[model samples]
Target: MINRRNMLRAGVVAAGVAGGVAVAAGPASAAASGKGWVSVLDHYRDAQGQERDDAGAIQAAINAATAMRPVHSVLVPPGEYVVNREILVSGLNDAVISGHGATLTLTGAAATTPGASAVLKITDSERFEVSGLTVVDNERTQPYNGVSIARSSRGTLNGVSVYGVKWTGLGVFDTTPGASTDIAIINCTAVGTRFGISTNGHDVRIIGNHVAMYWPSTAEAAAKGGVWSAPSDYYDGINVLTGSDRTTVTGNTITECGQAGVYTQDCTNLVVSANTVTGCQLRGIEVDGGSRVAVGVTVSGNTVVDCKGQINLVRARDVSVVGNRLANTSAARAASLIAVNVGSSHVSVVGNHATQAHPTFPAVYVIGDATDVTVAANEVVAGTPYQAPASVALLYRSAAGEFTVGGRLLATKGLGVGNAVAAATPGKVVSKIEVFSASGASLGFVPVYQSIA
Candidate 1:
């Protein structure tokens, strides 16, 4: 969150700027329109055609915005803009660039080149905005990143659509880690990219976006030796990683990503809630601690559907996965739908509903020396999209930790075992479910293998 002092500081822009015959002064169309505006056509009229590069004209419009006093907006209005070179918007204060009915097409020598491949970059600024733009690639043979925001603060991207990027569609970062604050990306659509949105800044909000087709095509995957993102495992739909603090990803419909739908790692205080995730090739939602283990993560109220691998928390701590709905989960790479593995601690998988589960594996699995994991009060239904036979158990904990499954269910028969429970409740794996004790003891018999469908 940016304070009042931060907002006031962002209002400072250098004065005494000018534009040429192709550009004009900005007009405040309404209360919603910005105080200052600069039209790119007023600066360079020949920039409208796709036959030539428009980077100079576009950059000039942005410069003119800052050159004007209290007029801080640039418009790439209602036309096609072809760019061969990268267009830069750098070192500004309190500015907006809107392109509601415009399209920016990138051509010639456009492909992923680490930090220099983005079509547009907003760097080293404060209180900046870019909204309502469409960015696409001209060459299907090669593509680059869509927009990159680096070392900026109090910035926003709203209602933007980006496609045909190979590396990252929308990326926000700071060279100095954790130095950025109060950035928001709202209602943006990213498609056909390796990573939809990758961020490592502070206090960022990624909300209400439609992101899909984030995996490489079959030919592209074969080109990488039958793997997805081999050199870099960053093909997720929305990635929050590395020094990101107070990040919130909510209310987005994410689909068909190669890695995970919403992936988080090496961050702090993340909240991934109310997102609909589906058709992911790997884990639907993964909180993997890649190097610097993420602390204070919460994944709640998301609907994960039919993903090959479901929600997994690997090497993370202080996490809560609650009130999530998982449906028709399929097992992939021998991992269950809900898995907490690899030395993860203080995790709670509580109050979740696993409906119509096709249990090729156990519905819930806590493995790999995980400690202090509680799988409680979950309603897990096996086999049957309400249709047929349900196989496998409700839970499996193969860890060396203190695990508890509260609410013992009612067994039809008294098949006594070493870790037997006095079956007293009714209606399936209800009240509580504990298949094995911490000391490798069986808690029940016949009903342990019984279908709760």
Candidate 2:
């Protein structure tokens, strides 16, 4: 049998031929000469090619490598390893665990019940990397996370896949007051978890990943709650929660989540851009201030389809929702395409395209003490007989801004200096503004300032 260590020791080399000409392969010994490479299969396996309960052997190898130097790498080759309990890798600096086609199949007590430990936990570590591995929980009902990193800084989780877990697939959190910073989750895929990826840290980058939550059938979705129930009861694709700052979630595809595809709560300085979100039971993307103030949030260049609501922001400040495309193809039961509500200020909704097949829903709805909002140059087309009283190209209640119709200001409203004005119609020739009172009574159109040139 060609075991992993023997294969590495033999330094297997292969040459390539291009156009019937042979080329020399690089030095075979150079590839296998890393002093820090330790194979887990060599030290802990049964006679029948089955991995033992050797979490301790893997930890021992890591400790041996790290004790000799500050940096090391542990190699896990292609096989299934059964881990009975959580494996801890703590207090290591500049360490890496690289798995090539390796799968860690968790079992036993921790896999049978909900516990505080994760399948693999890395804590109090810095400059770490875990890549090219798959972690799964066969007992899907247990609440074991695939990987948890807490109080760690400057870590990278690359090309990893995690599935069949009960809780979050990857969790990056900080228990202390100061935030964990510079964590990157790149090119990872997670599915069928409660949360695909979640973070409560700062300066995190989540890029080019595919994350999906459980997609229950219509009967199953209704049993959890209604289709439009509160998002707290359902799964989220990617979540950046309280006190997290300067986070970027971009270039990701999220689908089939029960809650918002990309959600932020009490998080500041967030950028959610270029993500494709679809078939969510709730809002596609939501940024809520909650008790803390969320500021400097930008949701741009996203495509959202077939969601109950899309792009919802509440109690946020200095937020920009720009250049997004949203569509509703079914009967709309929730809110509008874009909703800005309650204590939000300095918001800009610009250059978006929204289409609603249902006649009763609004394209954009803005209400409740929101100030300095600019809804400009959006193309919103809805079916006839709009049922929501506030359903229009631009709907505002107790919200004040400089309103424009086809690049012409409404002169009757007496535009104030520094009042932000937006051309509500993009391609159309006619421009109109229908104002409404707080009680949903129509105040009629503000007279156009002048005819278009």
**TM-score, one value per model:** 0.74, 0.77
Which lDDT values do the candidates have, in the order given? 0.70, 0.71
Task: Kindly list the per-residue Cα lDDT of model 2 for residues 1-453, writing each as its tens digit.
Answer: 233334443332233222223323322232422554545644555456665555765666565555656444566655566677787878656656766467777766354354366788888877777878788876665678788788878888888888867778887877752367888998998887778898989889999999976576534466766554543324789989888889999999999887879889898899999999998877899999989779999999999987778888888999999999998887645457888877788898888888877777676777746777777767677753122222223432222443333222333444312212344555442444555544445556543444556
lDDT of 1 by residue, 205-302 (tens): 99999999745555666678656665543468999988888999999999878778998888889999999998777788999888868789899999
Specify the poorest-scoring 10-residue window by lDDT in model 1: 384-393
Q: Which candidate number would show the highest TM-score if scored against the true structure?
A: 2
Show the colliding residue pairs in model 2. Answer: 360-387
RMSD of 1: 11.1
C-alpha RMSD values across all candidates: 11.1, 9.3
